[model samples]
Target chain A: MARAATTSDVFNAVAEPRRREILTLLVVGELEVGAIVTALRLDQPSVSKHLRVLRETGLVHMRRNGRHKLYRTNAPALQPVHEWVSTFERYWSNQLSRIKERAEAKMKQSRETGTSEKES
Target chain B: MARAATTSDVFNAVAEPRRREILTLLVVGELEVGAIVTALRLDQPSVSKHLRVLRETGLVHMRRNGRHKLYRTNAPALQPVHEWVSTFERYWSNQLSRIKERAEAKMKQSRETGTSEKES
Candidate 1:
């Protein structure tokens, strides 16, 4: 089947935990199908199915190495996904900054009151 | 049905483009279901289905406002997703940096050669 060509396809493919785990594995380096199946503790067919989805999403690239098919992360294909999710970063970033500010305020209060409670 | 309680669930729910669009709409502020449906140009049932998925994933919060249920983005629920995808930022960031460097180099070469070609 032709690979997915939209944001939904990319997100849907990665929606499976197994697929995310596969991507993580590829992030470190390329691996043969056997290693991926073993790492995920899933049956060969199940792993293959997830790999097919990943391949369709362009999140992974597969190459035949002799008799084995090796899978690697297609870093470029992930750029769009990364960019898309980045729009939400401001929300998280604002929350994180708020958290930091609260922590700093607490620390300042502790310093003023001579309390030894550690503020994280 | 009870909401999903894993990373997979969140990713799966947001995987739909309609769901993401809903999120974008909610980001600015909360909206009534009718408004969302109209904005997306989808039927009420379809929009409702997407909303259910979003609500199940905890990416959206709905409250009854009079006879209508207003939907809004659950900012905290999206934190994990944002953090998860941010890991891949380094890959795109590196690529962007590489592109910038190449552009700079090309610009320098153009200057040296007295060419006026713009490099982006």
Candidate 2:
């Protein structure tokens, strides 16, 4: 199968772990490329490439500050991704609640058995 | 750069729109391949391929029912993706709050000006 272009959409762009890390770092605030490189311990060119994909996909915003370019996450771009994943949230939550109910039932059964034994 | 394998991780596996559609469809309940093909309007081979990636990445679970195979979403596999994207939730929420504040301020100013005009 032909691979989809990473820069084509928010989901594709964020699929790369490096790009996600870059976006995570930017969430704190805008940072220059050099600062990103140092923070992630990645080389400058790799960081630039990831940032370019992110910028093109509208996942991050870049602005010029004199000779430097600063980047920050365009959080709204991630809304679609978040909303998509959130729909499945109920499945996990249901599993959790079921486990909680089982634990409570076991505790109650043990308490009732102890009381019956004491009465006998 | 060499493209990462889509089957390598949940993130890459879900980067494809078709695969996301397949997962969404499976969320309601387990379904066989033919049902998925009919619902998504995708050819059997293409749907099978996407399901393979989802299965390999543990995003979906497969089981045999007679001669047919059933598929369902392994929602917990998506926990990492959900957690990562959820961190950016505050950015959009903050923007919403800021917009709300501006509208409220505008309304208060209009009310105050209207009262002053009436008094004069």
Please provide, for model 1 over B23-118, each residue's C-alpha lDDT reduced to its tens digit, 9 standing for 90 to 100.
989977889999998998999998887788788778888999899999998867776767777676666667879788888888888889987676
lDDT of 2 by residue, A23-70 (tens): 999988999999999999999999999999999999999999999999
Residues forming the 10-long window of minimal summed lDDT in candidate 2 chain A? A111-120
Candidate 2 local distance difference test against the native: 0.89
Per-residue lDDT for A15-118 in model 1, tens only?
Answer: 66777888888877889999988888999998887788788778888999999999998767766666767777786688889989998898889889989777
Best-matching candidate per TM-score: 2
Measured against the native two-chain assembly using Cα atoms, what DockQ does each of the candidate structures obtain, in the order listed?
0.33, 0.64
* Tens digits of lDDT, candidate 2, B12-104: 888999999999999889999999999999999999999999999999999999999999999999988899989999889778788888777
Ten contiguous residues minimizing lDDT sum, candidate 1 chain B:
B1-10
Clashing pairs in 1: none
The TM-score of predicted model 1 comes to 0.75
TM-score of each: 0.75, 0.81
- Candidate 2 pairs with clashing backbones: none
